[model samples]
Target chain A: MSEMLWGIVFLLIALLVGFFITSPLLIIISPLVEWSALMPYTNRSKMTWLIFFLSVLYLLIFIGLVSLFQSNFNGMFSKELALIFLSIIVVEFIAVRTTQKSLYQLYEQNKWPQE
Target chain B: MNKDLVKIILVTAGAVLFNLVFWNEKLAINTVLFDAFLLCALFFLYPNARKSAAVNWLLLGHLVSLSMVVIHNTDLSKIAFVITLLLVAGFAEYIHRSAWFASGSMLMNVVMIVASFAESFKINKSKPANRKGIGRFIRFAIFPLILVIIFFLIYRGANNAFSDIANRIGAQLEIFFSHFFDFFSWQRLVFLLLGLLITGSILLKSKLDYFSTRETRMNDGLQRSRKPMRQKRNGAFFSFVEMIMGKMASGMMALKNENTTGIISLVLLNVLLLIVNGIDVDFLWLHFQYKPGLPVYIMVHEGTELLIVSIVLAMAILLFFFKGNLNFYKRNKWLKYGAYAWILQNAMLVSSVFLRDYYYILKHGLAYKRIGVLFFLLMVLIGLVTVFLKIWSRKTNYFLFRVNAWAGIVVLVLATTIHWDEFIAGYNLKRRNTVELDVPFLLSLSDKALPLLDTNIVALQKRENDTRVINVNDGQPACDTCFIEQLKQREKQFEQRQKEYTWLSWNYADAYTKQYFRKRGLITSIH
Candidate 1:
């Protein structure tokens, strides 16, 4: 049981370090959020919705892990935890791609106004 | 402007905070504040003047200057003297720029002489006059002092953490003099020093208007000498070479503009060159491997010969085939593919020396210390590859080249994986043979542990054991005989395991090291 707990802790630490390393990418991308606002209402709202969905996805992963800990079924919980973590990674990747595409679309649609 | 100031402050604060977090470094907050105050004073003093860029450039330049000062292993007084000479030279340049030509030039020359002397003696000194103006003094001193304090604090913290990390990590860094001294070979050292001198001279000359004026004079002369007879005689050859060179130059410029493709090509070229250099040596061959009177590998070896031959052949081939094919490569898809291959081949050959040295380092521990030579060779290889690619590809667009470069990486990675087991096995075997061992236990132990031994200990033990036959008083048995006997036994066991599992020898050795270290209490726990 202790070994399992330690493993969980190690996984969490690794996740945290990974997040820290990836933070620079997020910082670089954060400026695009302002540019996203200039898009047509539908496109803007779509991106907002996507971001909201991503947030929800992250929350769900956290909730699933917490629930797993609360329920004392180790084998099932471990398997589910792994699946949840993998899903989180997939979702993050998808979110980044979507954000990038939305940014490109916005740029394409909004050419500079002629003098 | 206030926003810009705030941004700068925020960036500075963030930088400080990052250092504090990662390195537990303390910022000399008072010193920084003082510097900021002084900078504000300077801004106020030069309110109407267009000096912002100058100030910013000076500050940026000082970062390099101060770093050179701090990192250089010289006495404080000597450092101060050198700094004084540099300041004098900089002031002289400032004077020259302000149009005091002859006097400024003389002063600058004087400063240079003084600076050179200081350099020869390796002496640099800080200026007492810099402390005269309260704001100017603080502006100069405070920032550097803060940087120093922060650096020291970070260094202390990092050292402690690094020591702890090293202790936790089973592999410890040991410096072997043989590897270390090999880097300082006279030829390489002389070349490096010469290169530095040449670069310094070039920079100094560029700063003078002498070259510009001479170039202008040459251009004027060329324009004046454009007679019809001369034009008729030289027109064909001149036009041909000019067209080729012009296209090449423009292509390079275009490639530079297309950053992604150009960079990828450059990187690919470098990687290819590295691979070629790495394979230059007949690593598997016996005569080259076991040569007496200083390993041929240390000095110039078969690898060098192969490298020269490959480069010459590549150049000849490229010149012959692609002499007038630039336009074709640019327009035709098939030709472009061929061009890409040529680029890859060139890059591989150029980067081979670096890759080979890197492989040696990875094979041998940090104890094999010819890092200087390795770095020098790598630098030279990179420089040559860059120049070659620039000339050949004409600075091709990064976007156009990036995909191909990435494909090359994928292929290389695949090749690496294919050879991964052999490399690991070889490395482990070398490592194991190097270390001291209890001959009986070593002979009995699994073949997997043999490669992990330090060569120094093994060699020493080998010597001791060899002498023991003549003097029975020596307790230890012959290491080479025992090692061979043990290896034979382990080889049979390994062969059996190999039949059961593909590449079991490599995997077993890796696992054995982990287990050995774990048992030795080097590792706290395995992940």
Candidate 2:
């Protein structure tokens, strides 16, 4: 497949996974992770395993949130929802930066395209 | 799990902990706990943050400010709380590139963090496929929905059969969704989104170059500009004079002109302030009198504000003169001496303001504004000292700001540690014989002062009987019985409220107040 096609496909897969689990972090991170695949330096097999690992991690977060909502929320009528959303944002930012940094490192190790 | 993943999970867990601590409660011990959790999360997530002296100091300041909320929690403490949070966010972002920042960078860091968050959320137009697709879908969806609604209305009007079917379907849909509507809270969803935005602003490091670039360019040294006089500049608005004087002598001439202007201005200002300060010393310091029937405003009203303006203007004028090449001029010694004299006079002016507030508090008893005046005067004194330092050390204006800003923060944090309400109550009570105690004013104090008021009930009653003591709330004579009843009612309400507080909402002030009431038999022990 062409790199452009691969990019779109990865993006679709990311959106699909994010939609399924309702994790904004994965929605943001997955496509970028896939984009890393196009880099000459990225090990394809390692990227695959990373994606799988991330999916499991996203699933755990999904489950944790759902259970917390069930136990702590009775239809989400108050400020606790706000606090939960705040935490989600903090998590999303950390995840994005970490993923981006790791990808840059991978590319740099293999003679980054920009250089 | 990797450290990043652990950080993510820990942050989320901290949010849950935050929710549990603050759900349906006021800020108190819960804020302290959440702050500690956040600091720990930051430390673990950003190991480099530990190396930054500014970050470490801010962390300590944050802990102290949060603890003040549990101890006293006045408006000053709350303001300190918010300032500390901004400082934390600023320093956290700054440590991404370097571990050090100027003291003035506190404000800039806060501003940049906000700007960076805005930058991060900015949608990339280059990534057109995703945005365009989403935009097209929303546009198509909205257009069709509107057309459908309009046509449905037209059809309903034209055909009774269709109208009946549509109405029946709508009713059934509403009935089915009423249960869902009952459970769904739009407020909660909106608050959740708001929380997300705020949290992202603090935690996310922005890619903005505005603040960092400016910070990198900033230097504390007062460097002499080597720009040739031939190049026209804004400061050379008097270039025609330079032309007439000749370029070789122009730089020296301009420096002499600035130096002469500064020296003359400072000298005149100092002499004028000397007269003012001398008068203040004589009236407010040496021979102060408590004149009965004199309004309190005469002593501390517009006068204090006007003097404060002058004091600030004094610093501004000195900064204007000493701002540039004047500091490096060979003949600038006399000018510097004059500047020093003006600063000394301003310090004396600040002392006079302090004395004025002292006399006002002595006359009218302590209030928020009176206490605020003291703090404001303290800041002015510090400002003057910093300005003096700036001139003496040949430092940049940035140095003045950096030193003064930190001084302001230190004063604010220190002020928050005191229980002002109790302090006011105690101070006013001690001077009941010398000053007219404002009974209604004391009654309006926070729960922290209740113990003090209760302890002095007999003395308060005696003052209430004196015709000189008036209920400022009304034109009527003060009644001790009415005052005592009001006090008892407040005690009851305080006890009931204290009982409702969980461990999360616990604070030393409330706890001690409750304990005091319980021991006095005003509140029964809960089994």
Candidate 3:
């Protein structure tokens, strides 16, 4: 049981370290998130609306996660801990990669304005 | 890969590093390094900023900041540290890139960043569709992963035997998590983000597309009112304000129809001020006899405040009378002289105020209010001088303002150098301290004054002992215990206060005084 728990701990630490290392990119891409979300189509006002919705949704998700985890949990690696850690890592990776691809496509589009 | 990225990275590093301020004070060195980093960031952001004396001034500011951290605390170092902040703003303005203040650079950078928000955001949509596989994999894995964790926790909670196994896991987890929890509470994380925002706001550049030239303009009335005031065409809010103010502006317009009323009022105001000054001269100075029972402190206190307000009013009156056509049009020469006569009399009134406050300070004891009155007098003197210069030079009111602002900057640089705690302690603890030595007040002074207090420690201890004996003999045995308890309480208070004074607040006066006392074996070395 001890060995199994240590294995899980190591994995979680690795996941956090990964997020920490890439946080700079995430900070830079955060303000540009609306572009990626609305890239498949083009409408300035609609993108603004989507940005607002995304922010609200993120706030709700964050609040919900905090409420669930901050309460008493009876295990070393409870469902609350696992979900919070995993969700954070997933969000970081997704945001970073999505923003990177979106920005690169933007550069390409700027290069070929005729399109 | 890009210049923008390089600049952004440097700024981000500075932002992130600044948040570690609470972790350890020795990391103040990081603040200096980050300031240097900011210059480079600014260079990239404002490519047009050329080499000038201002750059040297900026470098001097950086060196001053560095010395403030490294050098022994001294009398002047505290002031120099504050001046460094002003110089940084001065540096920005000197390069003609921003106003000679932080708000200008802060606002400019914020606007620059926000302007590119949409353009930067477009990058998010630019991703090729082929990445759908990776996206699909993430979406596919996340939901069940969450569900599995929930199920696992619920299963463990249901069985009593599961806790025995979990305790073993708890031991494994605690070791890894302790270090994490030690440094990061939710509060610290919030401060960390705030640190980032401040850093980015100060250093980030949205664009470097233009060079700022001196002629481009400053956001002040002097520059705007110079080239023939134009009609408002920008927006409704401004036009509305203009429409309302149009009548008032015409009242003080360059061309005037009602000069007699303005001129007659100026003459009467000057006569009234002269009477006030003559009476002050007679009673406060000439033919003055001390009344043993009369309260003189109120004269100094109330009189200083009243005199300052009077001087300010005197200047405003001059400005109102001499404004626009009254200044340039030749018919109001007598009115201008009356204004000058009133100004000179007001100057004398200021002098009387200074004398009264100074006497009060010397007779009583040095305190913050005494120093504050002195500073107020200095400002009033500057205002009076500016008014005289405006009248004699026949310069625009805007020009007068521009000059006064610079004067204020110089005064500000001078103001920050003072170590008030030490000054007050030393002044009060002088020979005059024997008569009315407020031991409680002396003790309230900062640790920087500890050395001064230590020099007079024998006298102070004797005083405290005498007070305790007197109180105890007056049928108050509790005073004996209270004195000892007070000493213990004060010692605890000093120790608590000592913890907060670190490199961030390191100064030369404190260092010198601390060293003086430590050498004499009065106390332990100042931390």
Candidate 1 overall Cα lDDT vs. reference? 0.40
RMSD in order of candidates: 29.8, 12.5, 10.0
RMSD of 1: 29.8
| DockQ for each model | 0.01, 0.02, 0.06
Tens-digit lDDT track of model 1 for B1-527: 45335433433343343332322211122223323443343334234322444334334443333332222212221233233233322322232221123234434333232122222221124532432354354446656986775554445455777546655552333233324335545334434434333222211211233322322322101011223534534757546644655654334353333333434444565566656444553443212343455543454344445556655555454333333324334433433444456555655544555555554444442221334445344443443454345344544222223323333323322222222323343444456545332344334333434344322234535654555767876665444445444444554564454454322112333345435544643211111
Question: What is the iRMSD of the candidate numbered 1?
Answer: 28.2
- In model 3, which runs have C-alpha deviations exceeding 4 angstroms? A1-115, B19-22, B26-50, B53-102, B108-188, B206-254, B287-297, B321-323, B433-435, B461-527
Clashes of each: 50, 0, 9
Which docking band does candidate 1 fall into? Answer: incorrect
Tens-place lDDT per residue, model 2, B1-527, is 55435634564566466556776667888887777766666666566877777777777777788889988866678789878776766676563222234323444433333333333333455885764476466645766986786566667766779889998999997676555435765454444434444444455444433456666765666777766655644456446445655653365567787677678878888888899888888988899886778876577875687677888788888887777777888889999889888888887877887777777777778898888888888888888888888888888876777677778777878888899999999998888788768777898899999998888765676656655354465667545476677788889888788777788888888888888887887522112
Q: How many pairs in model 3 have backbone atoms within 3 A of each other, for residues 3 or more apart or on separate chains, i.e. clashes?
A: 9
Question: What are the TM-scores, per candidate, against the unseen true structure?
Answer: 0.26, 0.72, 0.63
lDDT of 3 by residue, B1-527 (tens): 66546655665576666665434443234445555666666666655543655555545654654564444343344445534543453354334423233334445544343233333344446554556667666767778997787556655666668866877898877766655545546445656656655555555533322233332443323221332345424546435635755654334453444355566777887788788778888876776554677655787877787786787678676776665445666676777777778778888888788777766665667777878888788888888888888777665565566566556555644554455777887888785444456667777766667667666655566666677776766765443233234434554565555476665644454456546644764232221
Error of 2 at A21 (Å): 41
Number of the top candidate by lDDT? 2
